[model samples]
Target: MNRQTKGVLLAAGGASLWGGSGAAAQYLFSTTDISTTWLVAVRLITAGILLTAISLAHAPQQVRALTHQRRNVGYLLAFAVLGMMNSQLSYFLAVKYSNAPTATVIQYLQPVIIIVWLAFAQRQWPRRIDCISIVIALIGTFYLVTGGRLNTLTLTPVALFWGLWCAVAAALYTLLPQSLLKRYDALAVCGLAMLVSGILLIPSLFTIPWPHLSSGDWWLVIYIIVGGTMLSYTMFLQSIRYISPSVTGILSAFEPLVATLLAVTLLGTRMTVAGVVGSLMILLTTFLQAIPMQKILNLLGLKHHY
Candidate 1:
C-alpha cells in the first residue's frame, strides 16, 4: 500500500479507538461509582509507564537525554499540568455531565479555539473562511445545546460549561506540546508529561474511595489505557509521518462519528434531528479548517491568487 493509504488506515483506526474509549467511559460512569479524578489519574499513570517503557526500548538514549535537559524538563512539567491533565480531566467530566457523543463533538471545537487564539496573539483578523467557520461553530453549538429551542436546553448548563472547557483544554493540549515535540520524541515527551500529571493527581486518588469494578469493567478500563490512550495515540502520531497533518486532522472526524454511533446504538442515547444536524455542522468546521484554502478555491472554481 502507498504511504497515504497506510496513513489513512492508521489515522482512522486510531480515531475509532478513541471514540470507542469515550463510549466505554460513559458505560463506566453510568454503571459504576467511579469518579473521573481516580480514573484519569490511574489511566494517565498506567499509560505513561507503558508508553515510557516502549519509548525506552525503542530509543533509550533519546529518553535519557530528555531527562538531563533542565529547560525542556520544566516545559514538560508545565504541559503536564496545563495541557495533558486539564484536557483529560475536563474531557471525562464533560462526558460524565453530558454523553460521550456530545462531549466528543464539542471537543472538536479545539481548532476554532486555536484559530481565535492565534488571531489575537498575532494582532490580525481571521481570514474570511475562518470567520465563516467561527460563525458556523456558534450556530452549531447553539442548536446542539438547545436543539432549536431557545427556552429549553438539551444539555444542562453544567454540561455546556464543561464541554466548552474541554474544547479549551484540548486547544491547550495541542498548542503547548509544540516546543517539546520539536526538541524530543513525541512518545517520550508525552510519557513524561503523563507521568508528571498523574503523579500530581495521586493525592486526589486517596481522597476518593476506590471503585468496586466487575471483571468486565476491569477489561474496559484496560482497553481505555492500552488500546484507546496508548496505542491510539501512537498510531495517530505515526500517521503524520506518512501524510500531511491536514489529512490526519480531517480523518480524525471518525472519533466523533464512531462515538456518536456507539452512543446512540449501544447505549440507547437519543439525539434529536436538530442535534444531529448541529453535530454535523460542528464536525464540518474541522474539515473546512483542515482543507487547504487552495483546494477549497479549486473546488469552488475560483482561480484568483491569494
Candidate 2:
C-alpha cells in the first residue's frame, strides 16, 4: 500500500481501538469496584511507563529534545494537563455517570469545536460543505441524544453536564497542541505530555483506596493502558504526518460508530431504527467536516476559505 493508504489504515485502526475502550472499561468495571479517579490514575501510570520505555527504545533523540527545549516542554506539560489527564478523566467519568453511547456521542462533538477554533484562528468562515455537514451533524446529534423520541429528551442533568465537559476536554486535546506541533515532532510532544499527565495523576493515587486488585482487574488495566491509551494515541499522531488534521478528525467519527457496534455486540445494548439513523447522520456530519472541502473549492475555481 501507499504511504497515505497506510496512514489511513493506521488512523482507522486507532479509532477502532479507541471505540473498543468503552467495552474494555465496562469489562474492567464489572470485574472490579474501582472508582473513576482510581482507574484514571492506574491507566495513566501504566501508559506512561510503557510509553517512556518505548520512547527510550526507539526515539531517544526525541526524548533528548525535551531536556533541551524548556519552553516547549512547559507547553507540552500544559497540554498533558488538559488533553491527557482531564480529557480521559472526564470521558470515563461521563461514561460512569451516563451510558457509554451517550458519552461517546457527546464526545464526538469535538469536531465541530475544532472547525470553529480553526476558523477563528484563521479569521475565515467555514466552507459551504462544512456548514451543510455541521447542520446534518447537529440534527443527528439531537436525534441520537433523544433516542428518536423527542419527548424522551429528559436527559439526566448530571450526565449531560459531565458529557459536555468531556466534549470541551476533547476539543482542547485536538486544538491546544497545534502551536507546539509547529516546533517539535509529534512523538516528542506526545511523550512529554504523557509523562506530565502521569506525574499529575500521581497525587490522586495517594487519596485513592489501594486494595489488592484481582487478576482480571489487573489485566483490564493493562489492556486499557496498552491498547486504549498508548497504541491508539501513537497511531493518531502518526496519521497526522500523512493526512491533514481535518481528515484525521473526520475519520475519528468511526470511534463513536465502532463504540455503538461494540455496545451491541459485546455489551448487548439495543437501539431503534431512529437511533441508528441519528447515529449515521452524526457520523456523516463528522466525515463531511473532515474532508478538505476548501481545497476542493479552490480546485473548482471557487473563492472561499474554511
Candidate 3:
C-alpha cells in the first residue's frame, strides 16, 4: 500500500479497536461491579508490560537507549502522566458518569479542538474543505448524540464535566506522542507510557473497590488489555508518523460509529435512523479530511499542481 493508504488504514484499524473496546467496557460496567478506576489501572499496567516486552525483543537497543537518557525519560514520563494517563482515565471516568454514547460523542470533539489549536498556533485558517468537514462533523455529532430530539438526553453535571475533559485528553493523546514516535519505536513509546500511567494510577486503584469477576469477565479483561489498550495505542501512535495529529483525531472519529454498532448488537440499544446517518457523516468527514488532494484529483483525471 501507499504511504497515505497505510496511514489511513492504521488510524482506522486503531479507531475500530478502540470503539469495540469501549463497547466491551460498557458491557463490563453494566454487568459487573468493576469500577472505572480499577479497569483503567489494570489495563495500563498489563498493556504496558506486554507491549514493552514485545518492543524489547524487537528493538532492545533503542528501548535501552531511551531509558539511559534523562531527557527522554522525562519526556516519556510526561507523556505517560499527562497524555496517556489523562486520556484513558478521563475517558473511563466520563463513561462511569454517563453512558457510552454521551461520553463518546462529547469526546469526539477532539478533532475540532485539535483543529482550533493548530489554526491558532500556526496563525492561519484551514482550507475550505477543512472547514466544510468540520461543520459536517459538528452537525453529525449533534444528530448522533441528540437523535434530533435535543431534550431527550439528560446528563448530570459530572458527566458533562468529564465528557469535556475527555475531549482535552483525547487531543493531548494524539498530540503528545509525536516527538516520541519520531525518536523511538511507537510500540515502545506507548508501552512505556501505559506502564508509567499505571504506576501513577496505583494509589487511585486501591481506593476504589475491586470488582468480583467470573471467568468470562477475566477473558473480557484480557481483551481490553491486549486488543483495546495494547493494539489500539500502538496503532494510534503509529498513525501520527504518517499523518498530522489533526487528521488522526478526525480519523479516530470512527470510534463512535463502531461503539454505536457494538452497542446495538450486544447491549440491545436502538439506533435511530438519523443516528445512523449521522454516524456515516462523521466517518465520511474523517476520510474527506484525511484523503490527500492529489489522490482525489488523480482519481478524477485532474492535473497536479506540482
Candidate 4:
C-alpha cells in the first residue's frame, strides 16, 4: 500500500480502537460496580506514567526543559485540569448515564462548539458554511436528543447535560494545547498533562469509594487505558505524518460509527430511524468542517472561501 493509504488505515484503526474501548467500558459499567472517578483516575495515572517514561527516554532534555519555563508550567496545569481530566471524567460520567454510542455521538458536538466559540471570541461573524454547519448540527442534535419528538428526550436529562459538558471539555482539549504541542513533543505534553490531571484528582479519590475489579473487568479497563488512550493516540499522531490533519479529522469520524455499531452488536443498543438520520447529519458536518475551504475555493476559481 502507498504511504497515504497506510496512514489512513492506521488512523481509522486507531479511531476504531478508541470507539471499541467505549463499548468495553460500557460493558464493564454494566457488569461491575466501577466508579467513574476511580476509572478515570486510574486510566490517567497508569497511561501517564507509561507514556511519560517512554517520552522521557526518547527526549530527556526536551521533556525536562518544558518544566523549567513558568509559563509552560502554567499551560501544562491548565491543560491537565481542563482538557485531560475534565474531558475524560465527564465522558465517563456520560457513558455511565447513557450508552456508549450516545456519549460518543454527543461529544461530536465539540467541533460545532469550537466554531461558535471562535466566532464570539474572535469577534467575527460566522461565514456561510459556518452558519450552515451550525444549522445542520442543531437539527442533528435535535433529532438525536428528542428522537423527532417535542418536549421530551430520548436520552435522560442528566445524560444529556454531562454529554454536552463532555463536548465542551473535548473542545477545550482540542484548542488549549496547541501552543504547548507546537513547542514540545506530543508525548511530553500529553503525558505531563495526564500525570498532573491524575495527581490533582487524587484528593477527590478520598471522597469516592474504591472500586473492585474482577479479572475480566481488569482486562476491559486495560483496553481503555492502553489501547484507547495510549496506543490509539500514538497511531493517530503517527498518521498525521503521512496525511493532512484535515483528512485525519475526517477519517476520525469513524470513531462514532464504530462505537454505534459496537453498541448495537454487543450491547444491544437500538437507535430510532430519526437517531440514525441525525447521526448521519452530524457526521456530514464533520466532513464539512474537515474540508480545507480555502484550498477548495482556490480550486473552484473563487477568491472568497465563505
Candidate 5:
C-alpha cells in the first residue's frame, strides 16, 4: 500500500481502538463496581510502565538525558499532572456520569478550545471561518446538552461539568507537551510523563477499596491499557509521518463515530434526533478548522471580503 493508505489505516485503527476502549469503560462502569479512580490509576500506571520500557529499549540515552534537564523535567511534570492526569480522570468521570458517545463528542471540542486559546495568546482575531466554527460549536453544544429545549438538560449538571473539563484537559494534553516533544523523542517524553502521572496517582489507589475482577474483566482492562492507550497512541503518532496532520485530524473523527455506534448497538444508549444533529455539528467543527478559508466561505454561500 501507498504511504498515504498506510497512514489512513493506522489513523483509523487507532481511533477505532480508542472508541472501543470508551465503550469498554462504560460497560465496566455499568456492570461492575469498578471506580473511575481505580481504572484511571491502573490504566496509567500499567501503560506508563510498558511504554517506558519500550522507550528505554529503543532509546535509553534520550530517556536518561531527559531526567537531567531540570527545566524540561518540570515541563514533563506539569504535563503529567495537569495534562495527562486531568484528561484521563475527567474523561472517565464523564463516561461514568454520561454515556460514552456523549462524552466522546463533548471531548472532541478540544480543537475549538485550542483555537480560542491560540487566538487570545497571539492577540490576533480569529479568521472569519474560525469565528463561524466557534459559533457552530456553541450551538452544537447547546443542542447536545439541552436537546433543543432551553429549560431541559439531557445530561446531568455533573456530567456536563466533567465533560467540559475533559475538553479543557485534552487541550492542555495537546498544548503542554509541545516543548518536550520538540526537544526529546516523542516516545520518551510521553512515556516519562505517563510514568510520573501514574506514580503520583498510586497513593490514591491504596485508599480506595479494591474490587475483584473476573478473567473477562481483566482481559477488557488489558485491552484498554495496551490496545486503547499504548497501541492507539503509538499508531496515531506514527500516522503523522505518512500524512499531513490535517488529514489525520479529520480521520480522528472515527473515534467518536465508533464510540457512538458501539454505545447505541451494544450498550443500548439512545440518542434523540437533535442529539445526532448536534453531534454532527460538533464533529464538523474539526473539519471546519482544517479546510481552507475560501472553501468554507463558499460552502456557506458567503463572500470572503477580507
Candidate 6:
C-alpha cells in the first residue's frame, strides 16, 4: 500500500482505539467509585510513564532536545494541562452527568471548533463546503443534545457546559501542537506533553483517594494508559507523517460513531431515528469538510484549484 493509504489506516485505527476508550472509561466508572480527578491523575501518571519509556527507547535524542527548549517545554506544559488533563477530565465528567453517547457526540464538535479557530487565525471566511458541513454537524449535535426528543429532551446545564469545554479543550489541543511539531520532532512533543501532564496531576493524587481498585478496574486503567493514551497517540503521530493534518482531523470524527455504537451495544443506550439521521448528517459534513467538493472537482479535471 502507499504511504497515504498506510497513514489513513493508522489514523482510522487510532480513532477506533480512541472510541474504545470511552467504553472502557464508562465501564470503569460503573465498576469503581473513583473520583474523576483521581481517575485522571492515575491515567496521566500511567500513560506518562508508558509513553516516556517508549520515547526513551526509540527517540532518546528527542528527549534531549526537550531539555534545552524551555519555551517549548512551557507550551507543552500548557498542552498537557488543558489538552490532556482538562479535556479528559471534562469528558469523563460529561459522561458521568449525561450518558456516554451524548458526551461522545458533544466531543465530536472539536473539528468545527478547530475550523472556527483556523478562520479567525487566517482572517478569512470558511469555504462554502465548510459552512455547509458545519451547519449539518450543528443540526446533528442539536438533535443529540435533545436526545432526539424535540419537546422533552432537556439537558443538564452542567453537562452542556462541560461538554462544550471538552470541545474547546480538544480544539486547543489540536491547534497547539502544530507550532511545536513544525519546530521539534513528534516524539519530543509527545514526551514533553505527557511528562508535564503527569506532573500537573501529581498534586491531585494526594487529595483524591487511591484505594485498592478491583481487577477489572485495573484492566480498564491499563487499557486507558496503554491503548487509549500511548498507542493511539503514537498511531496518530505516525499517521500525520503521511497524511495531511486536515485529513487526520476529519478521520477523528469516526471516534464518536464508534463510541455511540459501543454505548448502544454495551451500555444498552437507545437512539431515535432522528438521532441516527443527525449522527449521519454530522458524519457526512465531517467527510465533506475533509475532502472538499472542490478537491473532487479538481480530481475530475473540472477545476484547476481547490
Highest TM-score model number: 4
TM-score of 5: 0.95
- Residue-level lDDT of model 3, residues 1-306, one tens digit each, is 787777888888898888888888888888999988899999999898898899899999878877889988988988898889999988988877766655776776676678878888999897666677789878876676567677864456687688879989988987987887888877888888888899888897778888999999999898888888788877887888887766786778778878877887878766678767666776666566566776678889987531
* Per-residue alpha-carbon lDDT of candidate 5 for residues 205-289, written as tens digits (9 for 90 to 100): 9999986789999898999999999999999989999998888889999999999999999999999999999999999999887
Clashes of each: 0, 0, 0, 0, 0, 0
lDDT of 2 by residue, 1-306 (tens): 887888888788888788878667765555567878878877777777777778778878877876578876777777899887888888888777765666787787777777777788999887677777678878876776687676786347787788878988989987778888776667667766777787787888898887457887777677778888889889987898887778777778767777778777887677767667776886676777667777788999987766
Which candidate would rank higher by lDDT, 2 or 4? 4
Compared with the true structure, all predictions reach lDDT values of 0.92, 0.76, 0.80, 0.89, 0.92, 0.77
Per-residue lDDT for 1-306 in model 4, tens only? Answer: 999999999899899988988898888888888888888998899889888998889998777877888999998988999999999999989988998888988888888999999999999988888888889989999999999999888999899999899999999999999999998899889998998898887876888887778888888999999999999888998899889999999999888988899999988989899988888887788888889887889998999856
Model 1 vs. true fold: TM: 0.96
lDDT of 6 by residue, 76-173 (tens): 77787877777888888887776666677777677788888889999999876667768888888777667567675546889889888888887787
Lowest-scoring 10 consecutive residues by lDDT in candidate 5? 288-297
User: Lowest lDDT 10-mer window, candidate 2?
Assistant: 23-32
Q: Alpha carbon lDDT of residue 56, candidate 4?
A: 88
RMSD of 3: 4.0
C-alpha RMSD of each candidate structure in angstroms? 1.7, 2.8, 4.0, 1.3, 2.5, 2.5
In candidate 6 the C-alpha lDDT for residue 46 amounts to: 75
Worst 10 residues of 3 by lDDT: 282-291
- Model 2 deviation from the true structure expressed as Cα RMSD, one decimal place: 2.8
Better of 2 and 3 by TM-score: 2
Question: CA lDDT of 261 in candidate 3?
Answer: 77
TM-score, candidate number 6: 0.88
